[model samples]
Target: MKKTLNINIGNSIILIEEDAYEMLTGYLNEIKFHFSKNADHFEIVTDIENRIAEMFREMLLQQQKQVISIDDVQLVIAQMGSVKDFENADEAEGGIYEETISGVKKLYRDTDDAYIAGVCSGLGHYANIEAKWFRLMFLVSFFFAGSGIVVYLIMWILIPRAATRSQRMYMKGEAVNLHGFIRNFEEELAGNQLISRSRGFFVELAEAAGRIVRTLGKTFFKVVAWLIIILGSCFFLAMLVGMAVFLGFSDANPNEYFPLNIVNDAYLSSMVFAFFVALAIPIIALVLFAIRVAFNSRAINRTVSFGLLVVWLGGVMLSIFYITKVASEFKEEAEFSQVRELKKYDAYTLTLDRSRFFSRADSVKYQINSDKYRGKVILNDMDDPYNLPRNVRLNIEKSENGLVTLTQNNSSHGKTFEAALSHAQNIHYDFSQQDSLLNFSPFLQLNRNTKWRDQEVTLTLKVPVGVKLILNEEMDLFSYSFDYWSCEDHGAPKAWVMTEEGLKCTKP
Candidate 1:
């Protein structure tokens, strides 16, 4: 029977009996003696203390003794682990930053993988919680606009990363076995554990066989990866050059942006170039991989893997950055304007007549003429000529406020439509009507192989509020790319054919 003394670990309080306390004190004295000459007396002592406390608790549980006895304390001392294990298991997480650490579990700011702050993910990982829950909680706290991101950013800027080796390893999901270091070592050796498949029968066999075969194979692959890396580099560079020239040509001239012309063009060009560049690197790597397979190579080089991993990580990060930027831009703008508004105003239509705009020069008029352009207008995609865009439509709506709204829509398959929408966003294209004519302008387009937009337009012209007129388009406006027209006494025709003289006639 013994009285108890309290010890605290983190937020948890531990009860130690008088007998155990005395015994623990004796063991501590021994450790102090052994580390007497060490410079880190504080660290050594702290580690030993935590280990003593943990074992004392374990003893109380196992022996069903309310008090930790001197015998139990002696047993703990007997269980006193090697310096390495003691250091590891009982090591105070030593704070997040080595320079600023005072104790374990220091809350340091993390600035990785976040637009504002990766606080949720980082902290979740540190605390062993699901990142999703943190994100939900963070979002819930703000109620709207995800304001927790800002708080996280603040935390990131203020917190420091775990400094101690042990702390850092824990942050990265590694365990620290300070008290069991030697025991674990002995256990591993006794069990003949294959921690890394190293120095084992199979490992030795593999090492020998691989050495004889892989050296040759590795050499061959190194050569191939080198070639692919070079060739892929050249291909990507060439695509860049071509894009630059085409964009320069388009900017120097300019083209008609009807129903998002520039966006369509730019989207097409950028996507084609990007696809070529993106796939080239992967393909080149794959080629090297194939060669490696043929030659019977093992894993990729650590350096090469590490380098590629960094590059891929960078790409993902950059993509997130850009997406976040764009999403922010759209946060304040969400309105759908109808077409038909622009028909009341005098508008000009620039014809997109060139085929293969993505790969062919002068495929669009702007490329043939513009000097203010940043890139060529490339078509994002087209259905098979046989399965061409159905429910494809164009309308000019005159709003009550004298604003014209022109809308272009297509009823295509979901995937194909998504591709088209992606093209529109990538190229910076949007639709709005002003003055009299519907201004269809696009920021970009995507390249579509084997499928092309057909020559047909559907049109519905809307007159301005309280405005009416008679108009003439050279051709009946069903909806076509180029409808020549001339107008006299009339409001603009929602559907009109372009005439050399202008809108020629008017209809109800």
Candidate 2:
């Protein structure tokens, strides 16, 4: 049964017992009267009141009480120390008014000592470790994939800068009493720094401009961080979906594709997973970092970050190992050529063959109904141009003898010459002659389940003197040795004549 009164302190509404309120009022009045003669008396008193309000709020939250009791007021007074205690502290050599208060250190960016953002200096105060050691650790971490830069940026965003004298004192583990405040103020005055420096109109204007630039810079960084969070998250999700799709199709001969075909089937899965890890981990880290910067909170703990780093390194190493192993398979190259006599003709029409020559395995895989489509020629679609490298080339030359002949040169690369020759032999190319018409496949195909080893086919057609040949419009794609496009007539199929010297284009 006691009378309670509502009072305003440091812009906070506090409900206190009548006796407690009276005691708090007396204490504050004593502090104000004592500091009334000081130049920064208003600032000092405001800070003290703010500190007391914070302590009261903390006490209420911690003790689960809505109203301040006499005991709570006494505890706060003891922690903050009385005006007499502060005076004694000023007189006593190296004797702080409140040991517990002096020991209460807070984490804040010490911008005064900062090379960048004062994060190391602030951490040094909180952890009681040298800032130089933290700097060294960050510098060393930079070599490990520039992870240090991300960490430093995140810390800068999350840790608040010490802006006020009391905050600076807290950051440095100093008491925030009247004695300590006066001493700090005197030290700053003695240093003759910014506070004591005389400011002219231009200097003040320059400082104002600097402040505006700093504020704009902060705003710009926040915008960039938000953009990164949005874009990085989307990219990360896409990568995850891509990895899932790839792994889902792992059993369905994914190695038949061009680049994947370069790797051995036995270790293809491992190599793909390693590559995914190497790429995906960095995106994940970037997204997490952006989230931290945008939200001003830690997205993950140090242990999880370190673990991710280790996994990323492992993936990179594994990818390198696989890449080296795959590269060694293309060390040697082998080529073989075969000559065949062609039926003599004065004029021949050459055309590109788009029809696919499906083997028994391909027919079974495609579930083609041979009886239903007996006479139908299924045209192979060339939608995916990079499904394989350009593996076909054509050349026309004058015949050394009076007879017409065709030569096919096959080439491939592998670990050994024999292996390369075997790979070359595994290549299947289509070429056929019907009357005076010659048909050539647009691209060469690999045998079923055969790994690609840069297999290629080069065809050379030798014709006697005065023999004329007509070329299809699409045949230019396969003729690299001859300037096929340069010999093209307006909207007409190209024609050529083989003479004693070489093949000559007849534009007319």
Candidate 3:
């Protein structure tokens, strides 16, 4: 290295050996002095200096030998594309296949967007056509296959961007830059994207890795953007088709496919909002996205994607919540009333309505007890009022070991209750002959009325089996009942109703 090496050539920031810098500067000064007074001169000289400085920087780094030799500068200068040669580009005119070119020029893919992308906004750049036509095309497709969006995304990721200056100019329909203008731009591009002069391979590796990551990120984004475009197109089409279906079938009864009271205000409101959201979101995104694609921004596209995802998740969760709330309320309002005389059936079975439950019920169990022994009973929910009519269907079975079972098929979600009497011989539960030890704390608390959260139901005491019983006026359940709805003028209620051979209905 020679002494006195600090040098700034046309803002290119080249670092050269002392002797090399001196020689290069001497040449530039001589050239400037020669053209110092010429017309069409000031800009011409400045641009020359800019180009020379750019070449010198490249020469310094190419071989990486300590000194920047004059020969290296000449070699770099030779590599620069000349305006005359570019003008003679008829040689490369048809290098790309004609069919491929035509197709390439017509494709549009969604990229990142602060708004939407399915319309003219995204298509304008990719297809060389104004975004308006693309938007209209997509709108039309919305009524058909609804697949334009998906196609758009696939195209975006697959298509390479116009990287070269010439390519960009062609893409935007700009005229080729003049000789001096091209030189100025080349210098500017070099300045904007300078390479590192580090000797460490590790540093170079790290930089390479960083570049790979950035490339990967951009590719991923472009691919995702295209997919979004296709999906948006599909969504738009879906909305249109949905409306048409509704209109065309409005006069026809669709009650067979839908629930009895399914069509309502909430459904209509949701459909309307969904349509607007589908139709407007993509177009809006396309505009903001077009801005980013054509220009540049601070990763605003990622922010938009993230926001859209959040809103989508919110909609899903909100729908599930709404369904659950409505189902619960409906069950609470619906009543299951059946009060009959105890004498009506020898063995009575009470079943809880399972239609009110979702797929959360899977297992079922049952319990069998004589007056002497008792246990647990469980059941599964198979009742679906939406798909099946409201009706009770239960078949009880008792195992040899005395365990009772009640079950429904094809569910993974809930539990049900099942209880039936076995032999009255060993299992003896007499409802009428009430045991003095049995506590009525929960059964009979006058303060806890049914209307005030703990209302009572009236059940007249029945006569015990094997016992001679006389008429009891208190057995008039209708008059003595705290709540008449509990057990109307039906015969006396029982703790255990005895059957002929020996079957009793009683729960422990």
Candidate 4:
């Protein structure tokens, strides 16, 4: 049957029982009477009253109570203390006051003088240190580890704001009782000169500039995080699709031309899986962290973050080890050389046959060596021996014995020289003779069981003096230097004769 009354506390509206209101009003009047003789007595009493109002609002909000009760008023008085307690405290017992702050220190965000969320200020008060030191520590840690931003944001969310003067007093390790409370109220009323002594105009200006920079930095990091999340997600999804289509579902996939095919199928799968794990986990973690920052969500646990880091590190190590294993397969090399005797001939024609070059119906078939040289010839049908080519190059020189000799040199690479030699010997080329005419195969072929190991062939023609050699147009991009000019640059057909000096181009 108790009547309720509406009251304003620290600009907040609150409802309280009539009895509680009377008790609070009498307690505040008593405080005002005690500080009556002081110069700043009015300011001190006003501050204390405001502190009581703020406490009332906090209790109502925290307890979900509809109206403040007498019990609630008495509890707040016990926490803040009565005016008589300050009068009883002695000032001569080797201290400014015999009474000390009895309430335990509490963490609270000091909104009165805060830069961003008052986290450093709250932490400083709780730890009994200067706030600027905490700020400096955060700044240094930001440059070194980037953990400061995360920690600051987390603290901002966790620490409650010091909405009441009593809470603020407790935050600074001051007693919430009347004696210590009066001292703090008077200090605050005294214009806060102690804290503001070092804060000049330049300090305020610098703080303003820092705020602008901090805002810009936040925006920049947001954009960067979004980009990393989106791009990383797209790339990770593409890898998954590729793996599913090529490795997971396909049977007898003929796309053996892939560079990863150098390793065994199982090892390739392991490597790709490791690489995907190495890339995807960090992307996911970073995206999650970005979302937390943008939304101000709960911070990730340290244990979980550390676990993800360890997993990413393991994936990286696995990928590097497997890549090294694959590269080692091409370390050793072997070559094959053979000399074939040619019948008596006054001249010889070095030509690559292109009879069915364009007759293939499948135009989209994976054609090797599809690149052009100086915009002249597209060496599509002729493989480049530098990367497992099926084509061979020809070199001509004068013979010492006045006889014609054709020497073929083939080379290949593998994990061992014996394996390389086996691969090199597997290369097949056809060269047939008809009286004075010698025909050579345009492309070399690898045996069905043989794998590509950068296999290539070179033919050396030992021509006698006065023997003329004609290079056909099909050998345009396939041939290297024969005379002073490059045979690959042949506009039309060219003829060269072996002399005592060297092979000389017959044309101007």
* Candidate 4, position 102, lDDT: 46
Give the poorly placed runs of model 4, Cα more than 4 Å off.
1-218, 252-255, 278-305, 320-328, 343-349, 354-394, 415-417, 430-443, 465-490, 494-508
Q: Residue 70, candidate 3: how far off, in angstroms? A: 62
Model 4 RMSD vs true structure: 17.9
Candidate 4: Cα lDDT at 261: 40
Per-residue lDDT tens digits for candidate 1, residues 420-472, read 33433322222443343333322123233212222222344443444433222
Number of the top-ranking candidate, with lDDT as the measure: 2
In model 2, what are the clashing residue pairs, if there are any?
none
lDDT (CA) per prediction:
0.47, 0.82, 0.40, 0.72
What stretches of model 2 exceed 4 Å from their correct place?
Answer: 1-198, 296-298, 369-376, 380-386, 499-501
Per-residue alpha-carbon lDDT of model 2 for 1-508, expressed as tens digits? 9999998888999889999998999999999998897789999999999999999999889989889988888998999999899788757644345644556888998777766667888999888898989999899999999999888876776677776776788898886766555667767776786564444555445445445656777788789998988898788788888778887866666677888889998898889889989998998898888788778899999999999999999999999999999989999999999999999999998998878654654555578866665555558646324558888988888887888888999999999989999999888888989888999888887766788898889999989899999997888778467777778588688898887777788964
Compared with the true structure, the alpha-carbon lDDT of candidate 1 equals 0.47
RMSD of each: 24.7, 16.1, 24.6, 17.9
Q: Any residue pairs clashing in model 4, and if so which?
A: none
lDDT of 4 by residue, 1-508 (tens): 9999998866677898999999988987888788897889988877877888888878888998889999999998998877766776524223323224346788997766677667788888898889999999998989977999998866765577775666787788785665445566767866665443334555456456546667787787778777876786787688788767766754544334434445656576778778887888877787777777666674577888889899999999999998788777778999979998899778777666532232122222344333422233233444323324345777877899977998999988888999888878887766777776666677676543245677778888898899987776656545554543543344766777789998877862
Q: What's the ranking of the predictions by lDDT, best on top?
A: 2, 4, 1, 3
Between candidates 2 and 4, name the one with more favorable lDDT.
2
